[model samples]
Structure formats: structure tokens, C-alpha cells
Target: MRVHVHPDRCIGAGLCVMSAPAVFDQNDDSGLVVLLDDSPAGADADHARKIAEHICPSKAIRITGG
Candidate 1:
């Protein structure tokens, strides 16, 4: 799977980081969503990424090529 994040659209909600820390993070200064892994490996990571995508309030996370 491929994951993409739009930091400009992020609201710093941290749901992505909370749900998928392996694939997402927050900037220390901006508290915005940070893309840790564009293509996370393994099933567990993929599942967590999907959850993050679903819960993102600003729809900043996008997944493709699954």
C-alpha cells in the first residue's frame, strides 16, 4: 500500500500519529501530520495506516496502490 499526507491540510489533530505512529508523526513545532512511511510494510502497519486515514479529521491522509 501507498500512503500520502498533506501537511498543508492537516489540523494537528494527532489522530494519525495516535493510530499509526509507525507510519505517521507530528512536527514538534507545527504539530502537523508528518508522513513517516509512504509505503509501510506488513499487514499490521497497513491496517493501522488505514485506520489513520479513516479517522483523519482534515482528510490529509490518502492511501493508494493497496
Candidate 2:
């Protein structure tokens, strides 16, 4: 799936990073959501979706076509 993170909407809660570290991260400077992988494959893709649809408290993570 294609993962997108909106840093502007991030609250620095870090749920995305904790849920899917391979696809998301927290900026060291801003503590905002930092997308580590825009496109994930296999199980990583599913994991990204979970973070986007459920885990992200700020709704900073979004997923598109797989």
C-alpha cells in the first residue's frame, strides 16, 4: 500500500511510530510524523494500513491504492 503522513496534522503522540516503525517515524526536531516508507510491500503494507486506519490518534497517516 501507499502510505502518506501529514506532519502538519501530527500531534507528536508517536502511536504511528510505535505501531509501524518500518513505515513511520517521529522527526527529531519537530516530533511530528515522518514517513519512512511511502510504499510498503507484503506484510509491511498491511501494517501500514493498520496504523493509518486505527493507531494514529492524530489521523496523520493515510493510505491509498495498494
Candidate 3:
């Protein structure tokens, strides 16, 4: 799957990082969402990414092509 994060829309909620640390992270300085793995492998990772996308308060995460 392909994942994308819109940093401009991020609100530093850190939900993505909490939900999918392997695929996402938060910048310590700016508190913005950081893309760790744009293309996460395996079903478990993909599921975690999806949870991140859904839980993001700012809806800054996007996933395409599962």
C-alpha cells in the first residue's frame, strides 16, 4: 500500500505515530506527522496504517492502492 501524509494539515495529534509507529512518526520540534514508511509491508502493518488514517484528528493521512 501507498501512504501519504499532508504535513500542512497536521495538528500534531500524534495519533498516527501512536497507532503505527513503524509507518509514521511525529517531529519532535514541529509536532507534525512524519512519514516513516510510505509503503508498509504485510497485512498487520497495513491495518495499523489504516487505523492511523482513521484516528488522525486532522485527517492528514491518506492511503492508496492496498
Candidate 4:
């Protein structure tokens, strides 16, 4: 699976960060969405994708080749 976050659409809700810290984080200055992992692996990978999709209010995060 591949994950990407749209910086322009992110609202800094922090939901994605809270859901999957290993996969998402804050940019500090702008507080926009930051993708920590482009390709997550192992057991936590699926969990990361699910949480990211679920919590993204703007739908900025998308999963491809699912």
C-alpha cells in the first residue's frame, strides 16, 4: 500500500497524528499533515492506513494499490 497526504487540504486537526504517530505527524510551523511513512510495512501497516483514512477530516490522506 502507498499513502500520501495533501498539505494544501490539511487542517491541522491532528486526528491523523493521534491515530497513527508512526505514520503521521505535525510539521510544527504550519501544523499541516506530515507523512512519516510513504510505505508502511508489517502488522502495523494496515492499522496505520485504516486510522489515517478514518481520522482525516479533509480526506487528504489516500491509499493506493490497496
lDDT of each: 0.85, 0.80, 0.85, 0.83
Clashes (candidate 1): 0
TM-score of each: 0.89, 0.88, 0.89, 0.88
lDDT by residue for model 4 (11-58), tens: 999988887788889999999999988888864477666777877889
For each of the candidates, give the backbone clash count: 0, 0, 0, 0
**Candidate 3, superposed: residue stretches over 4 Å from native:** none
* lDDT tens digits, residue span 1-66, model 1: 789889999999999888888888899999998887888888646665658889999999888875
Q: What range of 10 consecutive residues in model 1 has the weakest lDDT sum?
A: 41-50
CA shift of 66, model 4, Å: 3.0
Question: Clashing pairs in model 2?
Answer: none
Candidate 4 residue spans exceeding 4 A from truth: none
Tens-place lDDT per residue, model 3, 1-66, is 789899999999888887888888889899999998888888646665659888989989988885
Which ten residues in a row are the worst by lDDT in model 2? 50-59
**Candidate 2 vs 3: which has more TM-score:** 3
- The root-mean-square deviation over C-alpha atoms between each candidate and the true structure, in angstroms, is 1.4, 1.2, 1.4, 1.2
